[model samples]
Target: MSIDDTIGVLLVDDHPVVREGLSSILESADGITVVGQAGSGEEAIVLAGALTPDIVLLDLRMGGMDGAEATGHIMRQSPGTKVVIVTTYDSDTDILRAVEAGAAGYLLKGSSRAELIAAVHAAARGETVLTPSLAPKLFQARAKEPPPLTEREREVLQLVSRGLTNADIGRRLFISEATVKTYLMRTFKKLSVSDRTAAVITALEQGLLP
Candidate 1:
């Protein structure tokens, strides 16, 4: 097919062999082309700007910038370019981070070539794809009960976790104690907890804390 008819893809992986393998797979697929290969997120961002691929097959873990970081940068640089994370990580945190960073799809490294091709096509068409095992995690992410706490609430809860009193947290964050208390109260209501200790515990269990 012609370049205009093909699905342009930029493969971003740290390993040369993996890139080569993925290139071969994509090359044999119909209407798909490996327009460029990047060895790091930094390079991927640069190539995405230059090549303007329709899709980016990104790896999760790289030296300088990981897939989540790369996805954010690529989407910001080229909003039309879809980012599909191809990685071995299936942890809730990893998947959630990539999704939050605006990944168009998430596929495991062990997925069949057909699945990979399908994911790339789906992503190119502005569809969301996730490994079957990851679907539950996505639901759980959305089902985070009682809604999410604001950044300020999380900061106050983190301070609570560190055994900081309201006065200390207020001083440390350059806010008045009343403001800190306000944040804490909002956090408590969101987490369905009455006290700082319970709020921190709930945040930790929900993976809202770093």
Candidate 2:
């Protein structure tokens, strides 16, 4: 059921200018297509149901439904669709929330058009991409309370840093994929991060990850 040609993108933002600008940027790029657009989370849910775009460019601070809630709904409805969050907020909480919500891409508004295109393609490919750099400053921003990831959590995290999927991790460690997910869930709770990318980013920032 998966096609490998152009990556279909949906723009979700409350601002008219932002949505149009992003569509223009994606359309100008080769191997990418703008399939749909929405100004609110409700509209996005509707369009996503109809269009089922490969990747969604979501703004975090929207009015209703919000980007995080919309992301949850979209993924639940269309398991194959990838949501890429584009916003001005890079706070750890926001980043983690988006990741937990199942967003595969995160980029600030300051990113260049080329970066946006790259992120969209990456998301379409089921890869997570974080713009600019993963630095200490980011860790400082995202880390609160900062109890740190547990020992087992850190071990599983190290494997995650090695770019292994849950199935791969299970096979490598003689554990079930369900067990790997359990570890990941615990790690998610402890680190206060939502998804794997945020976990990796936080680990990298803390020098716990290579």
Off by over 4 Å in 2: 1-4, 134-210
| Model 1 TM-score (2 dp) | 0.69
Regions more than 4 Å wrong, model 1: 1-3, 145-210
Pairs clashing within candidate 1? none
Cα lDDT over the full model 2: 0.81
In each prediction, how many residue pairs overlap at the backbone (N, C-alpha, C within less than 3 A)?
0, 0
Residue lDDT tens for model 2, 1-210: 136588888899999999999989999998898888899988999999999888889998887567876787798789989998999887777777677678887799999998998888788778887776633434554565656667777878889988999999999889899999999998866655567876776567558766
For model 2, name the residue pairs that clash: none
- The model with the greatest TM-score is 1
Q: In terms of TM-score, how similar is model 2 to the real structure?
A: 0.64
> Which candidate number maximizes lDDT?
1
| CA-lDDT, candidates in order | 0.86, 0.81
lDDT per residue for candidate 1 within 8-31, as digits (tens), equals 999999999999999999999998
